[model samples]
Target: MTRLPPVPWTARADLAELVAALGPGNLRWVGGAVRDTLLGQPVKDVDAATPLLPEEVQHRLAATGLRSVPTGIAHGTITAVLAEGPVEVTTLRRDVATDGRHATVAFATEWRDDAARRDFTINALYADPVTLEISDYFGGLADLADRRVRFIGDPAERIREDHLRILRYYRFQARFGAELDPAAEAACAELAPTLKGLSRERVAAELLNLLGLSDPASTVARMDKAGVLPIALPERTPDGISLLSQVIAWEQAHAIAPDPLRRLAALLPADVRLADGAAARLRLSTAQRKRLSKAAGRGGDDAMDARALAYRLGMAEALDQMALTGGDPAPIVGWTVPAFPLKGGAIIARGIQAGPDVARILRMAEDRWVAEGFPDAGRATQLLEASIADAKIA
Candidate 1:
């Protein structure tokens, strides 16, 4: 019976209160919280597996005056908003049916049944909240100590149950399990092509998550060598391996910015062709699409001038572009570009008509102002008048 380390601030108080409220027989800390605790990693979310139904858990939480959200009521998940934070409480469940991506699960009363239905051994751990005692129905404690990510059942059967697990295995290997399991790797390689059956959005999200993981470049390189990345992101080329490695190192060193869009921008090459409507196909927001497009246009150069170009794009966009290009953007600090002092309306007041001529004159004036080291508003106005007069002569 292996023991896990003490829960960090993220889990300690919340789990203690929830356990006191729900009692031992009804609830236990489950999944990532337990796995991460054992691994000495900071737990991000606290999940509990319980014999009580979702509604019962909700009722219990409501009785405590804590706010509850039916986040996944149909799937037996209830989010209890504790003073510390929101804790996700889910009833023990067994998968009744699955089509690789989505599953139809039935709530269960037994812990073993719920643990058996999970994808990987490292993720199937559970712990008694009150006693802080650990439970390993599937030998997950040993696997966690060994840094292995074996499936709960047969590797092939697990992949068949959920193709997403194929990608998840790689991500887990990159994040938690450093040594690649031969059987697990072979299983993922064999089932890699089935990833094409997944929706672009789903595939994109999984890949983005992988990219955001630690040492993402190495993970991507591993995926590329295994021939899985092409099935997931067909836009990349063989030459992208170097670019991916560079970007991952840059991102790992500077953990301040960890957005997936920026990571994606870093992985992409300047000349790589995107599928028509690729951004929309991946369900990327308009701003994300625009940032990636700009990053792609700028290439991987992180020079001060390049950062200024990125600033013009938007600070968030610039940072993301810098990450995608695998370059340190810190040199782009204090980069201030002057804005046009006069508005189109102000220009129209100077006898400029509301036509292409007004736009043309303003652009010319702005360019001259920038060239002159960004003069004051008075000088900008004089430059605008001069440019307008010059345009009239031409």
Candidate 2:
């Protein structure tokens, strides 16, 4: 009888009270919380499985003076807001029908049925709240011990149920698996086109999560070879894998933290149109879209310093360009960009009237300021006067 070791979240008073209200043996710790705990990783989101339906779960929660939110009532899930954080309690579910993107599910009385519907074996493990005993329906413990990310049943069948699992397979394997499951890999490759039908938001979320890993180069290469990359990200070049490898190496060598968007930029060619298209397909936020477009390539001279690049583009995007281009980021690592000091008003105060000429003179002053290595406000005043004099002379 493998039992969950004593963990802080399992001992939370609010969580315990909620469990008591739900009934001693009715609810059990399940999914990522149990898996992460068994792997000795810090659990972030605590999820539980229960036999009680959503309404009954809510009624029980109300009796305990705890507020329940029907976060996913249609799918038989209710969120219990606890002092520690939110713990989601969902009823055991069996898929009534699936359309590769969304599933129609029905509450089930059997825990194995719920576990069976899950995508991966390792994620199906459950733990009793009171006894802390683990329930492995499909050799989840064995698979976890082996560091293998195998599907619950048939790989292709699981993928047909939800196309997003294709990306998830690679992500989980990248994060946790020692090697790819051949059947899973083959199924993913054959069904790669199915991912095209999924919502771009779903594809974007999973792709970003995969890129956020410590080093996803090998996994990405696998995805590229398996015909998954072309469908998931159409902007990638043939040499995208090599570029991604270089970027990851630079990040590790320079001790820079892994950033998902920057890594995605590495996989793309130095073409803004393609980058923007990819951003649009991914449904990235407006700011993120702009950053991706700007990071398509370096904007200025090849000999441009990090500070100059940082000045042109914002800090974060500058770092992306440097990392992608194999430049050292240490120069601007903690350097706060000095403000240009001279605004249009300051230029006008120097006797330049408010006109196109004033704007032009302000530009000249700013150019000189940047060219002079971003000096102090005093230097800016001197430069403004010099520029005004130069403008009158011109």
Candidate 3:
């Protein structure tokens, strides 16, 4: 038995009973939670596999006073929610058919068949929920130790099973894969165009996941090298890889978390219209699209220094713009933006009405105050007075 991090939710009686109800030697932790534990990383989602089918798994969970959510019942997955957290219970299975996006699977009793159907070896690792002993049916443990990501069987066969695996290969490479597998790379390149056949939502989600890695420049370059990027992002090129490399290094130096939109912005042309097109193609959420556009637009403007950016754009967007432009972030990391002294009320007090005219006066005053190096009270008052005078003249 291997000593592993404690599975937190196991302390709950409901979850403990659910584990027990599945019978001894039946339930085992699987997928990311298992793989990440072996790598000494924090686990976010807890998943497990059992030999019992979905209905059986649901029955067992219901016996423990736990409700079962048939999240993907047809695919043999049931999500059981306990007070601690939700655990996804999936019966061991093999893919019956796939069309790049959806897979038809049949439940199987043996773990190795299920492991063989997974996208990469490392992801196929399973663990004893109590003992923490890992089950490595396809040498996944060795590949995990080597930081290599290899398809379980023939690379082309796996690629044909689902073309999205090509992107997933790149995504895993960005996160845990230390180097590209030659056979997998060749297969991915040959089948890259099939990526366009996938739903825009799925490709967009995967791309964001790929870009959100601590550093993904090398993997992104590999994706481009395989001619996979242009197929998904029609107008994008590999030219921005070096720029992205610099941006990522600056992020690490400043202790910044990876921002997917910012990284994606780095890979796009420095034009807002082009970025907008990319966002539309990727079907980005409105908030994400707005942020990406703003970052791309401001990243190249040299006039907005660190403080001004933080003042106008807020810290998160400001820092994103900083990294995307390769600007020094140290100066702004701890700096606070000075507030403007004037507002619409102050303009109204200057004899202007409380309508658009007052708003216009305040806007003019604020711009002048910013342009005058963010002046003190005396200078702000002077600028306000000047703006009022100009408004009167007009």
Which candidate has the highest lDDT of all?
2
lDDT of 1 at 50: 92
- Candidate 1 lowest-lDDT run of ten: 271-280
Candidate 2: where is the Cα deviation over 4 Å? none
Candidate 3, lDDT over the whole model: 0.82
Output the lDDT of residue 334, model 3. Answer: 74
Off by over 4 Å in 1: 8-15, 250-259, 266-269, 272-277, 299-304, 316-330, 334-339, 372-379
Task: Kindly list the per-residue Cα lDDT of model 3 for residues 1-394, writing each as its tens digit.
Answer: 4445665543446656667878898898889988887888878888988999899888877886678899989888899886767888999998888876678888898989989998899888887867778888888888888889999899888888888888889888878888668999999999998887888988998888998988888888878877998787776745788877888888888888778778887888777788888898889999888887887686455787777777778777788788877777776777777888767777777666778788887888888887767879889989989989988744
Q: Which residue pairs in candidate 3 have backbone atoms (N, alpha carbon, C) closer than 3 angstroms, thus clashing?
A: none
Put down candidate 2 lDDT per residue, 235-350, tens digits, no spaces: 89898899889989988998889999999998887899989999998999999999888888554546778897789788998888888888888989889987888789886665
Local lDDT at 17 for model 3 = 66
lDDT-superior candidate, 1 or 3:
3
State the TM-score for model 1: 0.87
User: What TM-score does candidate 2 reach?
Assistant: 0.96
Q: Which of the two, 2 or 3, has more lDDT?
A: 2
**CA-lDDT, candidates in order:** 0.75, 0.90, 0.82
lDDT-sorted candidate list, best first: 2, 3, 1
Per-residue CA lDDT of model 1 for 176-235, tens digit only, reads: 886678888888888898897788777877877887776677777778788888788776
